[model samples]
Target: MNARREGDAAVQSYRRAQQRLRDGGKDVSSEQRLIRIEDALDALLDGLVKQREQIGSGVAVDVAGHTLAARARSRR
Candidate 1:
């Protein structure tokens, strides 16, 4: 799955977990779990933004040991 799709899934998971906690009443452990989920979501979103920016700017992007660029420059 793509980053965007993964991010969406993460959001849905977080919402479901949050709703469950709310229905069951909050506890220390559950709150901690929620915090961790939120942190993961934030990190995923941040990574997506960075990837989009890199792609838009035509910068070289490293993926699995290979570099991809929008337009290759000729060697001088």
Candidate 2:
């Protein structure tokens, strides 16, 4: 599957796991595990955002290159 979809799925799974832990009880161990999962999820989301921004910037660069080439051709 695509990167966006895969990331979404992972986020959903982590959220469900967190919810289950919360519903179970206030056990210290479970809370600690939940915190770790949350931290991981945050890192994964940040990475995905960075990837998307990079992809967008790359596309922008490609468009700018094409525009510049076209301008140069028009001047010739």
Candidate 3:
């Protein structure tokens, strides 16, 4: 998906996760919430990368590597 759509999805996911926490919802466990949050973060980062590319920015971001590192840190 394009940056805009991806960003929108990420925003929605983030809101959902936050709402769950605020409402004290127990349908999803902490681990599941962490995964959802990570997924949303990845999507947001992907959108940023795409936006940079579209704007012809000289900067480059390794989304996959960053995400891998984050996941590793989370597991530790």
**Which of the numbered candidates is closest to the native, going by highest lDDT?**
2
Which sections of candidate 2 miss by over 4 Å? 1-28
The residue pairs found clashing in candidate 2 are none
Model 2 lDDT per residue over 1-76, tens place: 2545555655665565555445534555766777766766676666566557556666777898999999999999
For model 3, where is the 10-residue window of minimal lDDT? 53-62
Task: Give the top-scoring candidate (TM-score).
Answer: 2
lDDT of 1 by residue, 2-61 (tens): 555545655665565555444533455767767766766665666566556545444332
- For residues 1-76, write the lDDT of model 3, one tens digit per residue: 3545545655665565555445535697888877766766665566565555544322223566688899999999
Which of 1 and 2 is ahead in TM-score? 2
| CA lDDT, candidate 1, residue 73 | 35
TM-score of 3: 0.42
Positional deviation of residue 46's Cα in model 1 after best superposition, in angstroms: 0.4
Instruction: Evaluate residue 3 in candidate 1 and report its C-alpha lDDT on the 0 to 100 scale.
Output: 52
Q: TM-score of every model? A: 0.40, 0.61, 0.42
Candidate number with the higher TM-score (2 or 3): 2
Ranking by lDDT: 2, 3, 1
Error of 3 at 15 (Å): 12
As for model 1, its CA RMSD to the true structure in angstroms is 8.1
